[model samples]
Target: MSIDIALYDGHPAGGRRTGARMLRLSSPGAALDDALARHTDPARHRLGRIDPYGDTLFDERDAGAVFEEATALLARCTTEEQRAAVRELRDLLADCAATPGSRLVFLGD
Candidate 1:
């Protein structure tokens, strides 16, 4: 199954249903999942706490921390595919961090 990390124009939880999708990154296999599973500590790694079986949402306020954790995770990736996926995630988080009113959502299986 694939997992998609999508960026939206505004906070989806606040009844902003019409927000346009700004970007979307998809993980085709277990690459992203396996990398995230390696870091279980929530205090140190926010990205690691994402539930692969459910949905996780992060607003512009959380983009910085999530980007940091994604960057850290990228450094630990051993495979090119894994690195690629995390890199894309990191980039998306970076963009989300810079854009106010934006929201990033991790859509899982």
Candidate 2:
């Protein structure tokens, strides 16, 4: 399984959405899931709740919190792949946080 991350111009509504400005990032689902599962406190780590079987949306308002959580997770990454993936997530979250109407979505499968 793999997870795909993308950044969009605004909140995507149903089937009418424009192309995302940022290139989508894909990472091994198991690797990310394992890293998140190892988080010591999932209750406080918002990113840990990413649904591997569904979609996870983070809008501009959620960017700060998501970025913080991603930073924390990045610190605990045991493998290079995990670190790289979380780093990409952090970058996307940062962009979303800075853009007024942008959103980040994690497509899981």
Candidate 3:
């Protein structure tokens, strides 16, 4: 699987904005849990927003590591069920990024 992170700008409210930095995991379902875990580490600054569309910045190195971990995790899944779950999670991520008012900043891995 492949994964990436993106910052999005949804609104302009003075200097405060609303958006989400998404960790996009494009691998199998089994890897979803690991991917989510890897991308949400507060210490590593890998966290993202909860809003439908919001703006946030992330470190490129950290994002790349998270994706690499996710892809490796997906590759180790032993069942189709796990792979399917990863696919579902990927779809959800894509949907959030594709929201009508969202602006995505894709970070290449």
TM per candidate comes to 0.83, 0.80, 0.32
- Candidate 1 runs further than 4 Å off: 13-28
Q: List runs of model 3 lying over 4 Å from the truth.
A: 1-31, 34-61, 87-109
lDDT of 3 by residue, 1-109 (tens): 2333343433322234533444343333224444444444445423333122333433333334344443544565556665565455444434544454443342223
What does candidate 2's lDDT look like per residue over 1-109, in tens digits? Answer: 6677777777655334554565345554566766776763657777877776799988888987777778878888899878876777778888888888777888888
Q: What's the C-alpha lDDT at position 50 in model 3? A: 19
lDDT of each: 0.77, 0.74, 0.40
lDDT of 3: 0.40
Ranking by TM-score: 1, 2, 3
- Which ten residues in a row are the worst by lDDT in model 3? 45-54
The global Cα lDDT (0 to 1) of model 2 is 0.74
RMSD of each: 2.2, 2.7, 9.7
**Most accurate candidate by lDDT:** 1
Error of 2 at 70 (Å): 1.3
- CA error at residue 26 for candidate 3, angstroms: 12
